[model samples]
Target: MLLSLFTVLLWGQQKETQEQLERRKQQILIEIKSVQQLLQNERTKERNILAEIEEQNRKINLSRQLIKNVQQQITITNASIKKNQKEADELQAELYKLKEDYAATILKTYKSRSNQSRIMFILSSDNFLQAYKRIQYLKQYADFRKEQGQEVKAKSEELSKALVRLEEQRESQKKLLAEQQQNEKNLQKDLDQQKGLMAIVQKDQKKYNDQIKKKQDETKAIDRKIQQLIREAIEEANRKAREAAAKAGKETTKSVGSGKNATFELTPEGKIVANSFKANMGKLPWPVEKGYISLPYGDQPHPVQTHLTIHNSGVEITTEGGSKARSVFQGEVLQVQVMPGGNKAVLIQHGDYITVYQNLSEVYVKKGDAVALKQSIGTIAANSTGKTVLKFLLSHNTDINNPQLWLSRSN
Candidate 1:
């Protein structure tokens, strides 16, 4: 009985693990589909080789992940199959033993089946007390036979169920194996396409390198401007606070320094907002509703040019064309920056923390406008390549942070 309980618990855990894996695999597949659709849309427009390569790379990565997930599922199914097979064998053996013992009991009863034999056996007792004891013993023996028969029936049913489970597991393993094969085939195709694109890129490495360098320079300029704006915003907020304190006839609060060392001197209300934003770290909504991170934060090697490193102050999320950028949290709009390329950005202040939504074609909320969570702030501009990408940045005072860390995982 203990062994059976342990087996049940083990099966339950494995089943749960399998279910989790299946859900993850399905999610990956959905993401792959989304990426493919984006890639198709890009193809309909003028080709941007770099953007195409990035999209392809994303699809390849998802494919590899799907393959890995399926492999894990196959591993689990194999283990389950093996376990069930062992259990079924054990049940068969137990059933065989039960049948053997029950047959022996039946044979013994058959030899004493005559009513006279049973009556005589009880009558032949040396005294009335002995006869009564004999009758009780016969009754107990009959009860034992009935219980043995019942146990045999139960064992037979258990064995049948085990066999059925074993067969089902085998079928599931077969299906998983087929699915894994298809995923491998698709992955191979993706690799082949990637190789073709890489070959084309290798021929004109210098041109692509120059493009990457130009883009990097633009990014650096943007980052510098963003930092400057954040510092200015900080100084402005602090200046207002100082004036308010002076009017109230209180001693002027000490300045919080300048540049990278700048910090917000929060008021009582500002402190609450700052604290709330900080407390909700990693639980904030995504800046966009239906998008995926095309580029992550920090310095990483370029996807096409591995020799070149790219620095990102924040993440870039690629979404459907014409998708509106939304606020991740409730905050007051601090600035509306119009870049050199005519693209606009909305900077929102949640106390000392600021979130920037860049690459906007239009802005809905102006400077000082109060925005609620998930409020549509602006429309993300689609580039000539037909790709709509949002450059999202997060900062505490003037210090930059990885926005991906603050955004929820579902994004």
Candidate 2:
């Protein structure tokens, strides 16, 4: 029983640690929401609703994970409790045996004779050998009785402590289970909020449909330009024979993955930025001062229809009204395009690393203009209906990134 109780106590400590992690996830979203909501009120931006919906989805996911963890813990805890009860039962039986033995020993010792009678009987021996033998026998009997009584007392004390420990374990399990239920309720609340936001977004669907179509066309154009850049790079590498022909025409064969991009023609600046991003994987700066992304980078479920899917090339961050989009690293502004959705977009080259900042109302830097890390390129679009989210993207030439994984976790 004691062992089982100790196991349960250890399990509860583990669950509490898991709960703390889940709580931290929730706290991050809440803080982000608090900042972005204030921006949404100031801007007439349509993308704010998108940001809100995405955050709600994140919270809901975390809550679901928490429920799964709690359920698992409950199963483990119940098994432990059953084992402990069995142990307690065995201990109680042992306790009863100890009591019976203790009582019988005392009855035999006391009922045998009065204290003076035992002494007198031993002293009345006829010789020295007889006296020594009688005294030894009496000591043996008395020692046996005292030992039995101590065993009974120890058993009772152990049983009491075990019971207390078991109760404490049970209480801990109950508390965790209750917290899990509360998380479910909170998830439901988030779902309702998302539904409301969806309604508002859908209401403006027709109004923004043409705008979306235009944006899509612009995005395709950008893709074509990127393809052109890649072709040019390949051609340039092929022409440079002194460069290693076996490895994309670079002087040195090198690695290009994640934030690192370029086989040939990697500028010194590109190498630095890639190295920095790698070194600071969990401490990269936020793209915007205060914003939340509505659209994420990847294939995602449509908010209105569960069966429908939407593919995005990059994540969209909604910043507050009149907030500016900033460069994440030192780079030359490659091009400034009139993007779809009636906003502006800027592309920057950091060695081989590239970043795209979209949904801007004005452009602060021009093509060929060198920009430093966190330098303002353009103000994020105002008149955003919900929240001002900055759609931040990182690229190693062409491959898209999951910004969530790349950026540092906000504390």
Candidate 3:
């Protein structure tokens, strides 16, 4: 009974492990595909070495992640194989013991085998009642022996099945190991490619540095303007909300303090939207249908220029050239502003929450236009450097949030 319970628990664990492995595998595949798209976009550029380096770095990181996930699967498979082997061993032992017990029962039955001798023994009883009692005892003994034989047969069949299952699990483990090895090889290849890219970057350090500096300046300027726009939008929304509240005879308190940096007091409807958006954190769809986050939000060391740290208020997605930037949620377009280099940005309001999509070539929605979830707002602009990058930002009132934290990880 203990062995049976152990087997049941182990099977449950194996099922759960398989599910976890499947989920990890799916995520890794999505990441690999996204990086491949980014690399494809980079290939179209005319000798932009920095872009190539960034793309290769992203690929290497993703490949490493894939290898890590494969290794984890292999680990899980190994554990399952061990558990299966242990269960098979336990079953085999139980079957052997059962066979031994059945052998002793058969020996005892052989000693009383002859039916004619048994009938004579019963006939030698003193009376009819005694003879009947002897017959009943003999019948019960025979039935007991038959039941023991059946049990032995059932145990043997069970042992055979356990052995077969153990063998299959071993085969599965072998396959998982082979897959992990292949992933490791792929990771090494990406690492080699990254090293080569790094060499090229080191040789052209000055030129690359200048180009990155220019790009950083442009990003900073754009971020400043976007933040300013968000501030203005918040103030405007607050003013309207307060007016609405006053007209409705509700006491309006400033949710955000008055000044350059102020938050918005939402109306009842806006509050609902804000709460809904907040609840969907880390579940929002990607701004682009297909892309990988090449540059993550906040401060980080450059992939090539380790000496320089780059501050990004939002994440930059490397996507296909013609891909359109989409709204991650149902929101109204706050404004569409053109940057210094003719790149357009669309800011969308989800109550107190706001999302900005930058580096767009054209706008599809005007200010105050309501947009649905996953609605395409504009086409992603391919910059003069031939890189199609989308800068995505998220904010709640005056505070900036990392877009990476909100966007779907698999998407």
**Judged by TM-score, which candidate is best?**
1
What's the residue-level lDDT of 230 in candidate 2?
Answer: 42
Q: What is the lDDT of residue 403 in candidate 2?
A: 66
Q: What is the C-alpha lDDT profile of model 1 across 135-205, one tens digit per residue?
A: 99999999999999999999999999989988888889899999999999999998998898888889998
Q: Write candidate 2's Cα lDDT for 146-218 as tens digits.
A: 7878888888888898788689779977986897788778778877877887788778876545554554566
TM-score to native of every candidate shown: 0.90, 0.56, 0.89
346: Cα error in model 2, Å: 8.0
State how far residue 352 of model 2 sits from its true place (Å): 5.6
* TM-score between candidate 2 and the true structure: 0.56
RMSD of 1: 2.7
CA-lDDT, candidates in order = 0.89, 0.66, 0.83
Model 3's C-alpha root-mean-square deviation from the true structure amounts to 2.8
Question: Which stretches in model 1 have alpha-carbon errors above 4 Å?
Answer: 1-5, 126-133, 241-256
Better of 1 and 3 by lDDT: 1
Best by lDDT: 1
Task: Give the TM-score ranking, best first.
Answer: 1, 3, 2
